[model samples]
Target: MTAPVVSAADLPRALLVGVDFGGKAFFDPSLDELALLAESAGDLPVAKLTAKRRSVDAALFVGSGKADEIKALVQLHAAQCVIFDQPLGPAQQRNLEKHLGVEVLDRTMLILEIFAARARSHEGKLQVELAKLQYLSTRLVRRWSHLERQRGGVGLRGGPGETQIELDRRMIAERIKAVKERLVKVKRQRGTQRKARERSGVLRVSLVGYTNAGKSTLFNALVKAHVYAADQLFATLDTTTRQLYLEEARARVSLSDTVGFIRDLPHALVNAFQATLQEAMEADVLLHVVDAASPTWFEQVREVQRVLADIGAAEVPQILVFNKQDLMDESLQPRTDEDFFELEPGRSVPRLFVSAMTGYGLPRLRQAIADCREAEGDGLINGDAFTTQPYSESDDQPVIP
Candidate 1:
């Protein structure tokens, strides 16, 4: 069957804003990410508003003063939508819209909308819809506030105080329940596939990291599959796996690309995609790819680690891969500096510096994967899992340039 068509005239123009909220590390990636979301939703980003804050106002995420500023900017730029880098509560969203005189979208909803548009596979679509429903279920009052005028019953007497938002919330809650049931079946099907792979005795290596950190790019280069690799955040939503042949030693392993993680990942999404992340948790090895050239790479690493922890994959064996080596220092001068996490004097994981785009250090990276694979007993599971040997918690081994 043919799919429905959407015309260009239906697109909206939007303004992107990043909120720092004081003293915290400002992650500029969220603005770029917001732009991606806007583009995915067929909107144009005309301006941005960034500010510091101690805490968000319960009514307006940005203070009334800042909200007024944004309101004026929205009018000056004639923007149809305002996108925030932080999630806004239902009351906050309603308050912001009423003050701005324009629609306002928070980080979570904007991301969910993008996922809704990008989801292709049945499971992917179902997961996205389920997450959207859950999010909407929580904020149904904010969405259908306009319907409060039509609460009359079948009889001439109108119902006293039944608001449209409450009714919509009920509908969304029911829909969420149905979606969860569907996802349960999808998860079960995925489980069967995973078990089949495990029985094949092939080493499973999952690539995981912050969004746009080059996981998909490296996956494409290594497995030679043209899975969508872009500079935009969350460009790839669905998990893609390919068989990788490492060496003439007949090393066979399945490398799976997982949905990229981000800071403040909505709980709804996390819950909806639990089965997808299980693929990573069950992997024999994890390639924690980082955009080495990014100024915030360290924070990105921490955020990815946090997500892994949330998904219960923190203890899994991981090899740190610093990608984008073409952007690395040209001198190739080896630096002995250790990251803050590794500053404990004797805590470290294997690390590799490489460029997925330029193909620099890729051979070494692949070789390192093979070496890690060799460390595993019978070439299955993290070798550390099977061995009682005291693994030394040492600094990242010095890379041989």
Candidate 2:
């Protein structure tokens, strides 16, 4: 993982903890995600910890007793920051920091920081800033708590920045409104461009899936574009679209790779990035990328589905593209026959397994996309037709190939 872009003055030692909350029995992919977050924050995670709890403790997220244990570990490890895997309310976060005597941040803030840091384009930066403000607005009330205690140093007067928490929250709300206004204009311009593309009759295909599932790799391989591909989560924040042709159709297809999804993606982030994700919603076809070798592939699929449902993109026609098949054992059954049937029953959405590294199964994957285009052009129904009602709610479901 690349070192976080932190100034020397801001550099701090950190410890990352992934609280299982009785989920340790699962493969615990969030542990890897937290490690990446720690690296992106310019903190070296010298120690890592996990705990199982029935329910979150309101005051100290991991429970008061566990918070004390973490505090001791922080002291022993000389840690300056403690990163948590789940989203922590401002009060819970403040309580944890007070107990540990260190800075504390939840997964949402950590991701926002990374997005703010990685954003290079003007629009991308503005989107991230808007998201930060929206998230900050919700926490302003907690920032000024206990101000009546008269905790202060020299030159700290009762004026200027020492207003009540409610006042600060109102200011943040105003700022959030301003940011939304600016974003509205930005979203409008993006919509205009999308409309132009649609008028041109281009078949838009979006790469949608969990983070680090090799969307960019498959993108670069298929389109021959030099997009950065890394092992880190949320590596690609800005949406990149390229035009590609398959077979002799000479069809114009807008291929987009957007931000990846994760478990419990903050609601603030979902609302903030809705414009960006609208690209997926409006696409003619969606390439749902999956890491074939991951032990938690099924769970990752569910997580992505949850995000899609949250964003109202569940209705979009999706083609399952299981990537990184090269990492799977050769002895495993072929994806074309028994394995594919077992994984994707009834062909609810077209599914193909491919190894972006070895190029194995890619031909079939590409062929599937090509077939989808052909079928679409021929006025044949797709997964969209199954819109009568999804399998989850309906019994007489017809499968589409």
Candidate 3:
């Protein structure tokens, strides 16, 4: 299917704002990632404002002076909306919108909107809706500014003598409950399928990494199935599972492509997509893909680790497949394909280099995966739990710039 193209002039002009607290390596100083996120959400970033603040202001977040500067930028660029790189409280969002005279969105809301737009499957749509509702449930005071709080008086469809905000909140609560119930059914269905897979004694492997890290590409290469591989952030939100046969190990494993992670991923989305993420959590092994060409690859690795930890998949045995190797400059490439992941005295997670786009060094990656599966599979039949090593506790190797 051909992708839809959006005109720049038709997209809303977004003014981006970020506050650097200092000492955070994951923080994007240029707000480039935020710009990508805005673009992914169909917004045109017209201007950017970055400030170094010691702490967040209780009301304006960026303090009054910075807020005024942001306001000027918004007006100067004719921005229709303002986006904050950091998450904002409901009151802080309201206060910022009132001060800037434009719609304001936090990082969480931006991600939710992208999910809402890109989600295709029923489970994906429901997960996004649930996250959006959970997020908006707290911001009703800001959402219903025009509607009076205490308007209902016995004849209203909502309830007798009920405030509009209260009625909406109640409705949102009921919806949240209903969506959660539906999700529980989905989870059980997945669980049953997993049990069936277990009965068949198949090895399970999941693809996981930072957004746009070529996970889908690697997945397509491994399984030979087209699962919507794209260059844009969050191109795949739904989990796609296929069977991958490893020739070297002579084993057929269930491979799943999961949603890519991002920096400061919203907790609500994490909670909402728990069922979808179950593939990663319960997989026999995880293929932790990474963009070998990114300058900030080390930081991206840390961000993906954080999400894995949040999803309780930190201990999953991972084979770090550095993808897009063909795009990496030779001068900056790893001195050797060998990398470290010390699991124990004798155990280590193999780090392999591969170009998913061109199929370079895929044989070594496949061999490494087949070996890992052979090792991990031995423990599976005994009803034993196995842990995936992520990193060394005292790993002090200098990050290759």
lDDT of 2 by residue, 1-401 (tens): 99877564566777787776675334363487678777875667778888888888889989988898899899998999998887798899988888899999877888888888888777777778878878887776466666534324333334444455645666677777887888788889889989998899778889999988999999888888988888887788888899888864556578898889877677877888877898988887888898877767778898888888888887677777878877876755342510221223444664566878888777766666676676662221244322222233244322211
TM-score per candidate: 0.83, 0.82, 0.90
TM-score of 2: 0.82
- Residue 40, model 1, lDDT: 70
Error of 2 at 372 (Å): 1.3
| Candidate 1 per-residue C-alpha lDDT over 1-401 given as tens digits, one digit per residue, 9 for 90 to 100 | 99878664556768788888665655474476678667776788888878878887888887899999998899998899899987788899899889998898887887788778878888888889888888777776776666766575653333456556666676677788888899889889878988888899888889999888899999999999999988877788899989999973368888999999877788889889887898888988898898887767777888888889898988777777888867766554235221222412344465566789988778876776776667762322223322222123364333321
Instruction: State in Å the error of residue 116, model 3.
Output: 0.5
lDDT by residue (tens digit), candidate 3, 1-401: 99888689989999998888886534687998899999999899998888898888999999999999998888899999999999899889999989999899988899999999999999999999999999889889888867866765674456677888888888899999999999999999999999998888888889999999999999898888988987899999999999888999898888899999999888999999999999999998888898988887878888888899898998787777888989988676765564655433555566777899899888887776677677774432222322332345565433442
Clashing residue pairs in candidate 3, if any?
315-388, 316-388, 317-388
Residue 340, candidate 3: C-alpha displacement in angstroms: 2.1
Ordered by lDDT, highest first, the candidates read 3, 1, 2
Best by lDDT: 3
